[model samples]
Target: MQIKQRHIEVFDAIMAAGSISRAATQLNLSQPAVSIALANLEKFIGFKLFQRDRGFFAPTREALLLQDEMAQGLLVLERITQRVTEIRAGSTGRVRIATNGAMAINFLPSLIAAYQHKHSDVNIDILVRSSRQIADWVSTKQIDIGLIDTPVPVAGLDAKFFNLECVCVMHRDDPISAQKSIAPPDLAGRSVVAITGQHMVDRQLDTLLSAADVTVEKHISSYYFAIARNIIASGGGVAIIDPTNGKADLNDGVVWRPFSPKIYHELALIRGSNQELGKAPAGLYNLIDRSLQSLIGIGNAGDSNE
Candidate 1:
């Protein structure tokens, strides 16, 4: 027997309304259309659905048995439709992000705020660690995205590189601040706060100083940029770091200026090579790029070219 949704709908409507005329009105159908639908439904199921007397209809035992299943089926369809609508509206999701301490301290928070304002239903998890750790996290699928500066390629991760400018940070009243723009030669004989570890930024800066044959007093060395910045803030020595980290230095009694022979660190977004960014993360990637560009004071608000 052949059957369709119209057959069930007309059958249910007739059972509920009790008369062909009332069922037609309820279904926005003519009386003859309702009667024909009832006849077809009875034919498809090979059973009589109603007992009629004086143009009134009543459900048979078979229809009473079918009503519960029909009701459940319609309920399931309603839920599926609602859920699809919710997905289209971007109403629910979760994303995890891991990044180096530098990006976390000076950047991501503000960007996350703006992102949350727009996608209020999305849950975000932010973790701050060493760049190497963040890369591993991305590769293992422990996190959805990462931002870091690395000179070497990480296996199982895709990178989008940006030429992020580095600068020399020092105490505001220090004599190097008077140089307008510092150089490898200008740093000679100065007490310097050097960033330690195998970080690419530190390595690049070290190579540049070596090429210029510049040597410093090497006052204090640390892995975290904030520690180095703190030393510089206390009038200890000059520290070469990113401008974003030093942008807040002035308030700390220190300031930063560009280096003469601009050395750049490659800052990139790292993600699992096998994973693709979804709607929320893609929006977040743009926000991150835009925030980085803004912090460096180099690009317009719309220059977020992932």
Candidate 2:
């Protein structure tokens, strides 16, 4: 007959408790049941596991040889069961995410840290790429989630859009920083730092400046809003950047003010179409949604034409 799990369990319990009656109590089985299981295990293995003297049970040489391995195997089994339970409860898993550089550098680290604080067992992998690359990864199911600049360059992916007003950031000591809002005319003749390569923010700012009959000297151009903020902090020039990056850190000698005519930096949270996110990814996804809503609400409350 094949060795059964009951045989191994009974053997382990007797070895640990050192008596048939005690092992029976530990396993909640009758003494006769424990004796029968141990007998069956010995017969199957062709060796004596225990030597009995009066009420005492002593481990045989063969039993001693198997004891350490059996204990280790049992520990491994227990750990596997625990990990399975954690998986079922949504407390442990790996989540893969991809996003554009702006959020990757300026925003997501703190959010990820807060998430890990509660679900420490959940492993997370974050990748920074361009918006188009992030969209492609989400569409192909290569990532659990993607945060990207809109419009989403790929189709067939589920996307949630957030429209955030861009803000003007300048050195804290700059006179414009004292204003609650900055209009295009306020930027006229001022040295401006802007995103490179005719980005959406640059186009929007250009249109507004033209409409206001004002022109600002473009002093510098950068690929990322966070980099532009660094330039602004160093007293390079004022910049209109995404509110997320603008308000990321205020103690860096930079202050953000709501910009008039309300240029918006659009972003989209994306995932594969028809794909269901696992528990850990879904938790993070919901957290990001709530946080972004809170940020947008704060920005709207502060926006004014005055």
Candidate 3:
């Protein structure tokens, strides 16, 4: 025999409220209706679920066992109902996002703003970390989406190229900038300002420096972009940073020039290969594409290497 939902609801209600009268009030039914529903449920289960003495009802061991199962079933039903409601409204109850600190700080704010403009009811929780951490979070389903630096395989990730741009950064006018182009040896012995949070940028720079055999004095390892910008503006040292972070005018004394070694970063919108994009997240992802296209003066989003 098929157990109806009303049977489960009445059973759970009585177990929760511990009184037929209270269950009737919570279920918005007459006291007789709740009593009849529980009676029908007991008959279907082929056992008396409760023992009555005077006016009070006490649950039997079998009732307790059924209550445990019904509790879990009711929770699953509630979740299914909530999910259906959200889908009908064209939004998700929650969206978890992961991204590198640099992108989260500089880029994600605008993308989120654009998304909320249309789907304001959708909730967003942003996790900021290094690119490697973002990748791992996506893999583990801890985050629904990831925005990160690229050059990695997208085999197991549904990735969309967000943007690509040459690295341009600032430093106070020094002997290094006087030359039309900086040679690998020119960086030798000079103080270099690096950021701890921009992990991919640090790795790429380290690879280039290692290949060129350049040895420089490390001035500082900082997390704040403002501090890095300030250090370079105040003639503290040089910083290799993204153009997105180079918007403010520090001073005419500090000049932002393209680095001699041609290096670029690919920002990708990544999700699990098996996960399908919901309507709101897909719309937001498209908005991210539009914002990146505007920033880089590119007509389309695609891998430059391809």
Full-model lDDT for every candidate: 0.75, 0.87, 0.70
Off by over 4 Å in 1: 1-86, 89-91, 290-306
lDDT string for model 1 (1-306, tens) is: 566666766877887889999989998999999889888878777899789989888778988998888777667766777767655665446778987777676667778888888888778999987788888888888888998877534687888777767777878788767666778898888887777765666667678889989876875787767777888888788887765666552377877777767766668788889687776676787778777666556611122111
Top candidate, metric lDDT = 2
Considering only N, C-alpha and C atoms within 3 Å, which residue pairs clash in candidate 2? none
Cα RMSD for candidates in order: 6.2, 2.7, 9.4
**TM-score of model 2 (CA atoms):** 0.90
lDDT of 3 by residue, 215-264 (tens): 97875877745556677777777776665554434444655555656555
